[model samples]
Target: MSAEGEQYGSSEEEDMYSDDGQEMEEDEQGEAPAAQAQPVLGPKEWVGLASMPAATQQALLNALGKLRGRNVNEMTVIFIGKQGVGKSSTVNTLLNERVAPSSPFQPENVRPLLAGRMAAGFTLNVLDTPGLLEGDSVSARGLMALRAALNGRKVDAFVFTDRLDTWRVDNADRAIFTALAENFGAELWERTILGFSHAQTTPTDGKPYEQFVAARVEQYRAAVRSTLGMKNLALPYVLIENGSRCKTNGDGEKVVNDKPWVTDMVSTMVDVASVGEGYEYDHSKAGKKLDPNNKHKIWILPLFLIQVFVLRPLLIGQIKRDVKKAESKAKGKK
Candidate 1:
């Protein structure tokens, strides 16, 4: 038996590379490549997934249901920032539930949850990570966890939650951004959306979103554009207030009760998820027909795995390590 066959058994190995010959033929003939086959969600796979708690499974299923027909297999969003930036609250708002614990003085609260979803099909799983602060020591375990969680996962988008009310460009933010670029590649900024949460705290008298962007065009727009090298790096920021949604007037006016910022944030997420080409499914047939471009099929499977297995765990580990380190330092001081 071949070396791979010895590891996975001959049958499994055969199944894994079953399409190798066909792929080679298409490549040699200069024919358009066939759509990659979907990973069979078999009994073993389901059982492995079922190891997660029932609640997690249900949450994942709910998220999946919301994404059905979008041709998305999985999506993961991680919230990173210093404590008190409302990362937990932002996650709760996104999931429409208080799944993540939040507190005022508690700089670090809960370990990352598989916040939104945990299953097969299309789902958005969120990770609420510990705050990365300037001059703070980050644990290797935390870094490992983050790396593992992100491995093989297709990040639809990332939200960098910063408190603009106390906006100071900090080393922690820079460090985290640098680490993300190193691990995930520089293109991550293109897939990232900066969420300046606690925007309601910003005095309404200062300036509107567009005006603010215009005023600090260099700091806000140009800096990010030049650093990320993406012309469209000007991300939208939202003002979020607990217990109330911002509303807007119909005539393109900001209503007193309008949460246009919140709406914009949500809309941006939808837009990101909607990007990349989509496949047309022909329901008339016994099985759905995949796109000839094979883009969707090729990307979705690995994306799903990364979100479920890698990103969530890594974020959680990072949070836990940070929390423990904070506790240790506190004890030492006492």
Candidate 2:
């Protein structure tokens, strides 16, 4: 998608998909189950039906019928991440217009914001929730609220957001991903894509921007692959900067993201739309407590602090006392 320019938190900007907001639907027993697809007619075709003539709609369906293994109607994408990780910003970039509130301080109280009807034939809907963090109840509740709102509708894809500059995925990110797998079964990774934003920072003063980005991109890829044990599965991710303001130069490229990041983002959504099943929210698996009991979910900074304040000082004092005792014994023998 091409953009004329980019702005943040503009009073003029509005949430075009605000009407898509929905509350969690419960069954007779007050429980929401995993998603089970009813049928698909191809989202792009469905969205374009209203705008096209009756004859055009018939021709499009006829052509779609001839094409085999291309039955994707609508892609339901849910963005789960930290408060200011640019989830709304990424959605705005994808729509090529403001469909979300970009103000860092603004409250996105609406859940599951849907895009305006598309004549382009692609059906894409986005749902965003409050941030999730480990060892934090408020954060966990935010994530659960999002899952609950889906009301057992099958999800086409789940976009896990992180930054290009950061070298690590925090404990909360890991826990949430784990919960997804538990809810949807282990194949969840098959349909998952890691989105890396803030790519404008890749090119530095003296560094070769292309090579620098390539190296960092590989690192992020490796991290995800190792965690999922999908050594052979082609690592899925999007590299782009959606957080910064932009001005389109004479060329179509934005000041922040010059690459066709929006296109790739949407295409990636289409690519993985069929990888997994619609999932149910399992509270038992979500919001894992961050402590030593869960060794796999520990943060590196906490481990380092333990060494500096707990382990390292103890070792140093022990060594000093041993040296003094040895010297006294030698002097007495002499």
Candidate 3:
């Protein structure tokens, strides 16, 4: 079977797949589930679809077809990470076009941008967001921009990007993960695809490539689990190399760790979408407790009532009693 003709499931990810977002059922006699009904998706002219490698285009089609079979007609994936981590590059690479602006010297603006494409009645919307971190902290402006950009759209999945070549996961990593969970809710992890960009780098420590990748993945997994307090969190990850010099297989598709990352990414996305849940962003719900204008406002009236109606009367009575006692003491002295 050809690369796309065969099922595109990654052998390395088979174990992770069963644990990550897939839901299954068993009959009374424990018979295998029947095949899903593959609904027809009307073909639309996606601008970059035809330009991608034949294998990549076929893999994408298969993934989208799986979604259509499960009655999902649209998929919205948002890419988010710190500055210069290749979020925009991943977006461009996945869509097979430069739909997003990615420049090493030029930083993305605080505002996020959403780009959409259509093929075979399946709509794919990708939101490329600004860097969520500013120096060591989460950027408030970026969070506000992301919330506004989403504009209450239902996000089917999130691709959280980071550098696979980074040597360590520090407090900054934990802070970003916590900030996302706080602003977007812990449910975001349920549909998250951890995209470790710059996957084509060699380890400086002289370790084997696969071993280095595993260690890096574990570092992120530990950080997310520790910071979010979700010990059982199963974070599915995909390695991505978006550079022009990335190595390609015989099919002219980008390969990392001997697997075509584009196909793996799309297949993983389809799995997450099949989990039957999408994150609904509510502008009113996010950052309310942290917003100074709204935080503690409800307690303002109650605090004022306690000060005036409760404390003032007691204070006045105590003063009057002190005055009478002073007068009585004066009389006794006389």
Each prediction's whole-model lDDT (CA): 0.48, 0.54, 0.72
lDDT of 3 by residue, 61-100 (tens): 9988998998888888888888899987787777776655
Clashing pairs in 3: none
Report RMSD (Å) for each prediction in the order shown: 21.5, 10.2, 13.7
| Top TM-score hit | 3
TM-score of each: 0.51, 0.59, 0.73
lDDT of 2 at 24: 36
lDDT of 2 at 5: 23
Q: What lDDT does model 2 reach?
A: 0.54
Q: Per-residue lDDT of 1-334 in model 1, one digit per residue for the tens? A: 0111001111311121111111011123222123333222221122223443344445445545545656566665667656677877777655455455665654453223334333464445566655554345333223333332343345666677766555455445455554444444565566666676555444455777656533432354454554456667646545555435444355332222254443456556655656653222222221211111232577898998999899989999999999999999999999
Candidate ranking under TM-score, highest first, comes to 3, 2, 1
> What's the distance in Å from true for residue 11, model 2?
28
